[model samples]
Target: MKRAITGLLNRLRFKQKLFLSYLVVIIIPILVLGVYAYNQSKEMLRIQGIQGIVKNVDTISGSIDGSVERYNHAVQSIVLNKTFQKIVTNDYSDLVNLSYDLQEYLTPYFNMMVMLDQEIDDVKFYTQTYVPEYGDSVQSADRVKDEDWYQSALKGKGSQWFSDNGLIVVAAFPRFFSDKATNLVYMRINEASMFKNVAALAKDGTVAITNDRGDVIYSNQGATGERLEAGQLQGMKEGAIRIGGIESYLVKKTVKQTGWTIYFIVPAKELSRNAGSIINATLIVIAGCIVIVLIMIWMFSKTMIRRIYALNSVMKRVEIGDLSIRIRSESKDEIGELTNRFGSMLARLNDLIDELFRNKIVQKEAEFKALQWQMNPHFLYNTLSFINWKALRSDDADISRVVTTLSKFYRTGLNRGNNMIPVRDELEHVKSYIEIIQTMKDHSFDVEYDIDEAVFGHTTINFILQPLAENAIMHGIARKESGRGLLRISAKLSNGKVVFQVQDNGIGMPLETANTLLQNDSSGYGMKNVNERLRLKYSSDYSFTVESAVDRGTQMSIVIPAYLQS
Candidate 1:
């Protein structure tokens, strides 16, 4: 079961989980509360029904007691009257007439008793001699007349005016009317009237009275008469019995005066009918709430799921080499922020890739240039060799001197095809090229060198100085006045850099052309190639600079970072 539940949960969507959470957290609680409310309502209704019955029984008993007291007062007034004594002791002739007048005077009292009994569904009587004329027609015995109550009524006993019943089902009050002689009156009451009164108060149920022998004395609406057997009556006297399946409440009270029991039966069904309505209403509300919660859960889950899918898609594309793909999310939440940052990272990655490609191309071009510079000097050596061989066969002395200078120039410049050599070797190559030029052309040019001997063995590209020297002597000197020019070559240590300068007093170039040659903005093959080689050897720190003004002279500086002779 546990594994099955785990699998079910794993297969369910986020929305399903959200809905289930609502069921556990909200809907279930609502159902529990509904059940709680139902039980509370049932209990409250039962309590209300019981309280109503108790109140009705208490009110009826009070009214009956009040009526009995009023009758006692009337009888006391008649007993203290002196006129009533003379009628009993001396007026034997008018005795029947006096009794008739007394009955007539007490007509309103009898009518009052009838009205009270009718409204409460009970009966009442005030009797002295079981008088049929006085309307007291209850069962009585000759022995009952001589009972303690009868004697007490004949002459008021113990200053006792009245007594209250401690139990239900029976009640009685004895009243005496004496004439200061042997004349007296007595009254008694029982459970019959009390039972009838209890019945009047009952609705939707029953009420009854039972004697000490457990016999049913009275009942209302035939309900109590049919259900109350002798044994049931005894049980009522002891305590109320709640019958099963009858949705009812029962209360019992025993009358102290007559040992009779009063039983009240009330149906719980009638009082608790509203409980069903409350439960139905509660269920309707809970169901509505569950629906609302489910809708909210679905919407939230969809929103969350969609964002996660979008992020996953972005990652998949990135994994497949689509580095340019980006997530476009406008929400200012955590997921949105994460996507935005990821997009930015991808953008940076694409930029870095492009930069790396460009760098690779630049490196390949530089390698090609280094290879070209390696081959150029070998070609020049072959040309100079042919020139020297021709001059030797002709036996020309000046040409021989020129050929020898030229031979030494090419040999030193090539340095046996080695690209790097000592700084002094390169300078000597420059001097040999100058000697060749002086022999073949003219000695009108003045040459000077200002170099530090300590830096003579430092390594440099073998033919770099010679090219500048040749350019100055040929193009620079050929345009000079009188065919004479000042040539200055200098190399020294300056601020951890090898500072080398070659200046010629000859026709100078325009600013634009001078900048183009030095900065190498235009690729005039020889100058651009030389500049590129320098860059390949020493990066941006080592390069050429040219300063020139027309007819003023041209000066060039090649700066190389200083390093040891090795």
Candidate 2:
């Protein structure tokens, strides 16, 4: 299966392969992580929402506790006042004195207490003494003696809290009052000021303050008049719960001072509402990233595939034997490098083809020229022998010698239509040519032969040394100024190779002229032809060099591998 998959992938183009790689290496992993992150974010937001609401409920509970504490302090102050106690317990004989004491001390004290706390709407004293009914401030104890809250306050040691008609009342019995009378001071607390914190929370969700009797004393949900059943809110301190058939989160705190519980109820959907937005935003970001990555992948694949396609086109052209195409790229990537290397290979291939054809043409030309010369070698040799016999019979020694030497030169040069010859035969051929040149130039130049015996065993290309000797005598020896030109011809074995040198102390040419002698074809079968012939025979192993200085001398050397005669 794995091999089948690999084969399938390998058949795809570069762009397709790149896209597939991106899908597996980049896109798929991103999508997986995005999904995981979205789920984690949703859970985190839900948990954080619950935590936030719990903190708000705790803050509101503390604020309500503080308000209730202040109100309690106010009630305690009134109960512990000695003057208020004396006034409530005094037996008055005149209504004028009773009214004077009530207006002078008790009214000012009550007004001061109310002024200090804005939540206190009113302060009233209920007594069974002969105190006149001083409006609501000094109410008769008989007015509320039978009232459950009043009775409770009289029997209770401390103050008792009561909720009545949208008001929070604190009823407390005065200290040291007459036992015959049930005197109490009750303070009216503004419900709005007392439950302001709970009201603030109501704007967001349902909030309620329930008393110990399971009666909701203050409900922002308009359920203040409703009563809860026993254990209705049990085990609902801080977690999700079902309220009125709707799933909601419940956070509850008890105010120790009032024995009332504050309940902050928020629907589960509402808490998760923000989580939805966060998840949506996260998904959008992930989608945007994926889109950008896809674009980049596409661009990268396009770039790479375009270069490959170009290379493919060039290769197709080459397949049809067209090797002249040129491709160029400026990129530093591996694809560009491959393209450059391919171009180099094509160039090298073209060079080898050209060199092979050139070598073949040179070999064919050499054979044709040899065949042209072979056609009349026997006839020319017979004619030259007849001329030598005639000169010998007439006593013309120079003519006989020239004719004899000419016959010898042609005899050795032809060598029975074979291109290979011994070193001794080639040297004899060159000696005959030199004899003819001396006869023509009147022996103007001196000649020397420094041949090594070791080189006699090796063979070289025929007719190569004759041209060098001719060039030396014509271009070097013939151009000498005053002194007789000295021509030196030497052959030796050096470093497993055969070396032939032709040198002359004649008027030498410039360095540039000497260098171009082997390159310029117009120089004619002298150095350039010999160099090409040596290369055809030995490739790059042979070396030919010309060294000369103006008016000094010229030296030409030919080096080839030492091939022994078989």
Candidate 3:
């Protein structure tokens, strides 16, 4: 199965490969990321929503507890008042004056509390010091002593809460105000006014207030069958609550002083409902983004595939030596760079081909020259040999000896068909050429050799020495008059290499001109040919150098690696 799949992929073109690659590169990651982001965002927003709703519930709980606490302080304020305490005392016999004073004290206090908060329904003291007036809200001691608020206050020993009734603060005063009867101060608050903001913050939620005994005293959804049970809300400070086949988020807070638990009941799915639209909108945007991304990938990959196809076509043409083909692109992408480099390679390839053809033509000319070279020198040597033998017969010894040396020179110079020859043979060849030149120039130049005999067993490139000798004679020695011209040829072994130098005393050129020896060799067929041949055979490490000083002798040198027989 893997092999079949691999074969299928191998048959796909670059266009198909690029398109599929872009889909995998773009679509898969975006889809995965989109899914991950959607889930994470939904969870994060859900937590924030639950937190915000719970925070609002806690705020409402705080407000209710704070109002009741403020009432405790208000009630204590009138209780500690000296004049009102004295006026409301039972021992005061002037009934009209005492009652009038009592009315005066309590009326102003009542009006003040009523104006301060709507929760303040009324504030009253049921003290034993006072009797109830006609149509007054204050209760006499006999009618209210057994009341729940009064009983609770007595048990509490100070301020006490009967949330079903109100706050009852029943106290025993000293003999100065109430030695005979108990003094009681109570403040009744409106339940609806106290929990009004809870309704506002809850919106769609039910607000339930439960006492420490797990008894529900107040709920916004009064008498609803689906309301949270007291047992479910107990000890459940915060979390999801399930009851009666319904799920809800239960946010409960306790009023520490009153032992009252305030609950905000909300549907558990409310968080999801709030966040559903956002995740949906995100999914839609991501879907649109993916569509656009796929389109962009298709377009970009198509352009890439088209450019690659063009490059492939050019390569096919290049395979058959058609180097004129190329791809043109204005983009600064990798493909464009590849096409540019490929074009450069083709251009270089064409240049090398032209260079190779030119070098081959030069080689054929050199070979033709080698053939002519063999014929001309051999014919001259043979003619000279005949003349020398004839001259010897006639007893002309000097002429015969010179011609005999010339014969030997041409014979050894050819060196059978070998490019490499003995160093001694090269030296002898140079000697013969110099001897002939000396005779021709009327011995104007003198010849000197400092060759080591050890070098005779080693070999040198053939036909190398004769050209240097010719250059020394013609360019340096022959230019001078009389015995002033001198030619010296030397060869020695140095540091595992051979150094051959030809020095001449004549009209010497400047150092600047001597430094450009190889460059100037291009102007001469012999020097240029020898320089190219040496460079081709032995590389740039085997080279020539020319050194000269004005009015001094010039030296031309060749240095090459020495080869010893294994």
* Highest lDDT model number: 2
For residues 85-166, what per-residue lDDT tens digits would candidate 2 score against the true structure?
A: 7667665677777778888988888788778778888888888776667887887888876777776677776767776675
Evaluated at residue 88, the lDDT of candidate 1 is 32
Full-model lDDT for every candidate: 0.63, 0.80, 0.72
- As for candidate 2, its clashing pairs are none
**What is the lDDT, from 0 to 100, of the residue 508 in candidate 3?**
73
Per lDDT, what order, best first?
2, 3, 1
RMSD of 1: 32.4
Model 2: lDDT of residue 188: 79
Which one wins by lDDT: 1 or 2? 2
Q: Candidate 3's residue-wise lDDT over 1-566, tens digit each? A: 99999999899986677668767777777788788878778777778768877787778878877876776666667677776566456546667866776668667767777897767777665666556542343556666777665666655554555655532334433344326666666667777777777768776677788876677766766222555567766677577776556676777778876788888777766666554766777788778877887788778876658788788888988887677765566878998889888888888888898899788767845783575375766578779878998998999987987888878787777765566777888888888888888877788767889997777777776777778778767777667664578889999988878888999887777888777656664434466566666776677778687788766778888888887532
Off by over 4 Å in 3: 1-34, 129-134, 165-180, 222-232, 235-237, 272-281, 290-566
